[model samples]
Target: MWTDVTLKQILLITDGCSNVGTDPVYVAQTAREQGVTVSVIGILDDGALGEQGQREAENIAQAGGGMCRIVRTIDLSHTMQMVTQRTMQLTLQQVVNKELRQIMGEDSDALPPDVRTKVARMVESGTEEVDLQVALVVDVSASMTSKMPSVREAIRDLEFGLLARGGTHRLVVVTYPGPSGEDAQVLRFEGTSVADAVGALRAAGNTPTGPALFLAVRALRDLGESPATSSVRANPEDREEGRMRHYVV
Candidate 1:
């Protein structure tokens, strides 16, 4: 079994449009090319977000090769977990589809009903067992002020839910437009709790979504190379071996 495969995801939690830096969609696409899934969760304001805001959110997720959802602050907690899991399944399915094409010269969608059903089941099962490394590219833009309290609580809830899962996991929280003039800052969550880092969050500054995403993606790439990671890509042989074992390609 390819148990060493650590599912990587960058979950962008934003409530409004990106008003600064490069276009987030392009940056997300770059992350996807490096095998990282970037999902987005847009927090609704007064139960509404502008059309442009909605389009940008959807575009970013699409470019990242992941999923996107717009939800109320109250639903953020549940939605975060849902998006995370669903995107993981999506990532696995993509991997499997490529394998099917390379090995069988057929795509999953073109497979017979019975074979497709089995593939779907296998992807679902992978979601439950694969280890996870998720980074939250949070927007502390001025508009997110009132939503901060609920956002903090939702993050804590997401952590608890992740801990309950069968596979091991780690969390990274990065906020955009840092207080002291940084584009993005990676906050360490000491002792499995996000108290200190998230507590210092100030909802001020432009929504530099693209720069923040680039920061988080680079951080994750470096992290995956660390010895602490049980990632299959730790070595060349394991990386090739991973493609074979992970999807039975």
Candidate 2:
């Protein structure tokens, strides 16, 4: 039920700061380099997240080329939907702009008003028609136990809304701090249905968001979702210091 032109993403739903493992920001950047966008939603119903937690969420999204937000249990459903849709639109725009640059040497914004308007319409339509493959990296740490109900509801809501789009969607579920002492565990590796996985979710172990993200990327790769990594001339804007990926293959 999927298509060839699919957008791959990792949507991380967490409640607090990572207490162990690798740095999430670095992992997020690596994911972006590998053709996956990583978005984060910090749950605030339990208590306010610390500054470090807030910063990490923001940094991860920026590094991974996705979106980030902090929301309460009641607002999670809306936030999740917003983040996923907004990220998909943004990614599609970047792709469209990249193509425009190759053809006209200018981005959409630099085009004549009429031309820009047409390009915008195409991007909008593409956003609604393009397929999606999302790996939901959920936080199963003990602290998140009380929020599982809301989490489950949000997942269902997200799936319902996305499936209503013209394009097909494939969803995978992965939870961090595996019950058996691992960094992350894959409850649902295939797609769309997460009920079984949600029932299997257990609240235990310390948070390990970084390692969990790494595993999520690996899982997506295992499923052959990420685009093939090949060498290409770096875009001019991407030539800035710390942004270059010359001859990447």
Q: Using TM-score as the measure, which candidate wins?
A: 1
- Summing lDDT over every window of 10 consecutive residues in candidate 1, give the lowest-scoring window: 229-238
* Global Cα lDDT for candidate 2: 0.79
lDDT of the candidates, in the order given: 0.81, 0.79
What TM-score does model 2 achieve against the real structure?
Answer: 0.84
The residue-by-residue lDDT of candidate 2 on 119-231, one tens digit each, is 66666665666677788899988888888888888888887877677666667778988888888887753344475458657888889999999988988887674453222
lDDT of 1 at 223: 75
lDDT (tens digit, per residue) of candidate 1 on 128-237: 66788898998887788888888888888887767766566777889988888878898866564774468668878878899999999988887777654332222233
Residue 74: error of model 1 in Å?
1.2
User: TM-scores of all models?
Assistant: 0.86, 0.84
